[model samples]
Target: VCVPPESVQPPPGSHLPHLSSRVMANLDDGTQIGLAMSRSIGDPEADRLGVIPDPTVEVMDVGALVQEAAEALKVESEDEVELLAVSASDGLFDHVTPETVALEMARSLYEKEGAPRPLLAAERLIMLSSRFWIEPQQVAYRDDISLAVTKVNKGGKVKA
Candidate 1:
């Protein structure tokens, strides 16, 4: 819910929206907003500028995923995961690639013992983002690390 589309691709020959980078949307007044995403839950100012509260949803068969990972990893032990779901704000997404997040989650879940540690996976992803992306900056800034990792089983049980 935090990353904007990065850049808006206006249709064929149309003009782009009048906005700045990152935040994307600009106000009618001489105001530069720091709002992150193009979609938000509740922000009247950003809403006026075309940010909607709509969300994108996807459904998939985690059984197939489980089998696929079992085959790929070649170890169908108890640590074999059913599903790994990562939800984060722009802080993580901007700093790290999806693959990096996936690897971190996979390692946290598979390499660790006992029940899937989605919380640890989430923490690792956040730390990874801050450590690699923000810590090396000349002027370090704090972005809200709103993230969660969820493990969903075949029986629709969720653990976080």
Candidate 2:
């Protein structure tokens, strides 16, 4: 998780430049990079700000979460909706939450035009999230978005 640059509990004994939150770190190459991520790789300046590449393992039941959110979408049977996992870059998460994506997928399943599928749901999610990242009214940025969605049958086979 990325904490505020100005937050208390800064890296132990690492004195950052003044106005720490605005500018993350200054590299030896005369380039300054601003970032708040707590864990990363290939960033020497970030190391000064206490960022580490060490990964934290968090185990969660994403399938249960999606199933709960898509409770309204179970038209045929209880097992009709079996979402196994979700992966996305910060670009997608900066604008939308997992709950929003799950709810949107559930909503997409109800469309009247054609067959409801997770692939279509994934496309809708990218399009919706892009509005927040690229619009001038919103927080505009050049960061790209990436994510995945798929269904899993009882036999553990994946369906796109």
> Which candidate has the highest lDDT of all?
1
Backbone clashes under 3 angstroms, per model: 0, 0
Model 1 lDDT at residue 117 = 71
Model 2: per-residue lDDT, tens digit, 112-147? 465457677787778777887668545565356778
Assess every candidate by TM-score.
0.58, 0.49
lDDT of each: 0.64, 0.61
After TM-score superposition, the amount by which residue 9's alpha carbon in candidate 2 deviates from its true location, in angstroms, is: 14
Regions of model 1 farther than 4 Å from truth: 1-36, 42-46, 75-81, 110-121, 132-137, 156-160
lDDT of 1 by residue, 1-160 (tens): 2234545445556665333224543568966556544566655665556676556668777777777778887885635545668777777887888888877776676564653476766776788778765566645755666777665666665456
Model 1, CA-based lDDT: 0.64
Candidate 2: which pairs clash? none
State residue 140's C-alpha deviation in candidate 1, in Å: 2.7
RMSD of each: 7.0, 7.5
